[model samples]
Target chain A: MGIAREHDLHKRRFSRNRGVGLALAAFVAIIFGLTVVKVSNMDVVGSYAAGSLTAGGDK
Target chain B: MSDTSARTTPPPAIGGEGDFADYFALLKPRVMSLVVFTALVGLLVAPVPAHPMIALAAILFIAIGGGAAGALNMWWDADIDAMMQRTKARPIPAGRVAPGEALAIGVALSGMSVVMLGLAANWVAAGLLAFTIFFYAVVYTMWLKRRTPQNIVIGGAAGAFPPMIGWAVATGGVSPESLLMFLIVFVWTPPHFWALALFVRSDYEHAGVPMLTVTHGRRATRAHILAYTLLLAPVTIGAGLTSVGGPVYLMVAVALNLWLIWGALNIRRRSEETATADGYRAEKAFFRFSIFYLFLHFGALLAEAALRPYGLGGW
Candidate 1:
């Protein structure tokens, strides 16, 4: 019984961790995309601040 | 159960029935959330700008680093945590996660966060994050916590570094504005934590951690709270005078400091007998308010940042 329980626990833990590395991979891809955006001179901060302020219109 | 069957089978998992949530708890999500928010504010309010995705990546790495510190802290303090009622049910102490697993996760994530932050941002930010993890895991948890009442006082620097790291990620260096944010949190920590110690005195006593209330009496601890809060008011106000601040931050700081100082004074005036009679209500209220004190201060910085394009922010 103890052995069976141990097997089940390990099974569950493994199942839970399944694709965790993939999730991390996605995060890495997103970070890579960010690096590309930064290197390419995508001025998201300045543009967004300008757009938002324009939209707000003196508020 | 034959000996052959037992020998053929594997042993029970050292921490039985542990689940995904238990591992998440090991990350100390609450602490991570606070670290993420402060780092984001630091990045946003910097004079230098970053791409949104880059900023997001930096915050993510910083949060992971904070969680790594928390996991390592839990691993080291498992024994003490088990003794304290407040932490007796943490993943390690509750037997939901093995200490070895926590340590593995901590060390692995520490390297991952620091290296990733370097890739996502700058080496300076990455170095700060690495030092933050080391300070929390080693200096605070392994060394100071069990030895002295000043553990949180010095260890608070670990928490205060996130904003500076964020600023470094944006500007590639620390500045007066970033230092001001760091100073506000650093000074705020003792008063904030000491208030908690006042109410949760027995937990630290039972855990044998030498909190101020443990080393000195409640009266001295209360005195310390008042003294620190008084000292904190200036740093809190000084932050408003920096590039991060404007009318919004200044107004918020002044109002909050008045209330915080009042709370500390109230606690100072109340005797231990009085606090006991009322269930330490004043200290509890102060503790609750202190959380808002930090959030609003940072929120005001965000507000100031937002208002900057309109020429309504900064000195």
Candidate 2:
């Protein structure tokens, strides 16, 4: 019977587990987005490299 | 057999059944909102700009860091929270979340937020965020909160750091303007909190939190609010002279400070007996206005930044 899938404990904890799962997923997405931005040199390092020549440019 | 056992026996513990909302409550979302709004204004008003993704992530990390510090504070102040009517319904006090669990979450989130902020922004912002967490959790929560009447005065620095950190996120370091923003919030804190202390004096009394009202009497607390409000006026208006401040900010600052000082005067003039008769109407109104005062001040800063490109924002 696979230990009864409709356990009360699972029912009670479903929301918590879902919340944590969503949070972790969001964390991963943020990291991925940050990684993409950093690698594309769209962040601080990129601006520093571009210097005054690129200042007041696409911001 | 399992069904039979489940039907026959009750759950062993009801207190640990907290769901996601309870966990979120530990983060103090209301406080986080203030942190977010102030930090956003600080970031926007800076001369430099941040990438959209970086800016959004930096704010997110700062908010998370602020929330983590709140959780840590809740964990440490669980006992006091349990006694105070205003805080007794919090997650830890209500027994929805375990104290240890709250502490763990706080520590973990604090670490994650700092590291992530460093990656998304700059180390200067990250370092400032770390110091802010330490200031709130260790300095304010552990050392000062229960110790002195001036707790909120000094502890206010923790709340004041977010704007500075946001400015650093864009500029990669602190500047005069950022420090001006910090000073504005720093001075604004005592009056704002003291107003709440006036109405909810009993909460601090019962919690043994050593609030000004509990130690120095309501009359003294009222005077303190007015004193701080008087001191805050110049700092608030002085920001108008800075690069970040503009005509719009100055107008907003002048109007708000006038109203704030007027409100504080009303609070100071009232006797406890009169306040009780009026249900602390002036104090409560002052408290509510203080919130709007801060929001509009920051909003004016944002308006200046937004209008700067149009040649109408700054002095």
Report the C-alpha lDDT of model 1 over A1-59, residue by residue, as the tens digit.
67656576686678557646666788869867876887566577778878999989967
What is the DockQ of the complex in model 2?
A: 0.51
For model 1, which pairs clash? none
Candidate 2 deviation (Cα RMSD):
5.5
* Model 1 chain B: lowest-lDDT 10 consecutive positions: B10-19
User: Candidate 1, after superposition: displacement of residue B235 in Å?
Assistant: 0.5
lDDT for predicted candidate 2 compared with the true structure: 0.93
Candidate 2, residue B150: how far the Cα is off, in Å: 0.4
Instruction: Give the alpha carbon lDDT tens digit for every residue of B285-315 in model 2.
Output: 9999999999999999999999999999999
Looking at model 2, residue A23 earns an lDDT score of: 94
Superposition error at B158 for model 1 (Å): 0.5
Alpha-carbon lDDT, every model: 0.91, 0.93
Q: Compose the digit string of candidate 1's lDDT tens values, residues B175-209.
A: 98899899889989999999999999889999889
Which docking category, incorrect, acceptable, medium or high, applies to candidate 1? acceptable
